[model samples]
Target: MKISEIKEILKGRMLCGEDRMDAVIVAGGAADLMEDVLAAAAKGCVLLTGVTTDHVIRTSKIVGVETIVIVRGKNPPKEFIEMAKSFEIPLMVTEYSLFVACGRLYMNGIRGLDGSW
Candidate 1:
């Protein structure tokens, strides 16, 4: 699915990388832990998380994440958004909790890295 579609699905607000909203995402993964993202996320997937840190943006870059969806309506720090913009990674936030965000994406046909949810 596309990042734009994800935004619509989750009622999300784009924080950065507006140009990247058209980017197509291959999969989705939800994790607050950076280690889980490194180990489980696929290249070009969307990452759903509650954690909003510069570390999250860094990990997303390393993992080739196409988008970062901050759950539970949390707003990340300005520096975090700046770092994401510098890395060319798209970032968004949703009012939905992590679980709901993940489920909505899954229900909309975005799957896990292995193509299973």
Candidate 2:
């Protein structure tokens, strides 16, 4: 799914990299643990995470994640935003919990990293 579509589906607000709204998410997963994120998601993924840290951004960059959705309406610190900007990762804040965000994306036809939900 497109980042724009995911944003709409989750009723999210863009926090950074608005220019990347047209980018596509090839896979998706929800995880707060960076280890789980690394294992579960791959390149061009939409990551629904409750944790907002530079580690997440760095890991996402390493794995080529396409977007980061901070779940439960949480906001990241200014440093996080700056880091994401530097990495060119799109950041979005959503009111949905990690599970709901994942479900909504799945329902909308975004598959998991393994190609199944």
Candidate 3:
């Protein structure tokens, strides 16, 4: 799926990296724990999380996540947004919970790193 499509599905607002809206997202994962995300997320996956911290941006960089959707209507901090922008990562926010966001992506044919439904 495209990053633009994921934004529409999740009803998210782009926080940065609008130029990357056309980027293809091959897989997705949702997690608040950076460790779990690193362990389970695939490279180039769109990460769905409620944690809006600098660590999230750092983790995304480390784990090769170029797109991130902050769930539960939480807005990311300015520092976090700046970090993501510096890394050229697309950051967005949605009102949906983590589960709902993940379900929407899954139903739209975005699979997990493990290729599970």
TM-score-best of 1 and 3: 1
Candidate 2, position 19, lDDT: 96
Which residue pairs clash within candidate 1? none
Q: What is the lDDT of candidate 2?
A: 0.90
Evaluation by lDDT, superior candidate among 1 and 2? 1
Tens digits of per-residue lDDT, candidate 1, 1-117, equal 888899999999999989987899988998999999998998899999999888899999998999999999998999989999999999999999988888888898998876574
Q: RMSD in Å for candidate 2, one decimal?
A: 1.1
TM-score of 3: 0.95
Which candidate number has the best lDDT?
1
Q: Considering only N, C-alpha and C atoms within 3 Å, which residue pairs clash in candidate 2?
A: none
lDDT of 3 by residue, 7-115 (tens): 9999899999999999999899888999998898878899998998888889899989969999999877799889999999999999998898999999999998886
Least well predicted 10-residue stretch by lDDT in candidate 3: 108-117
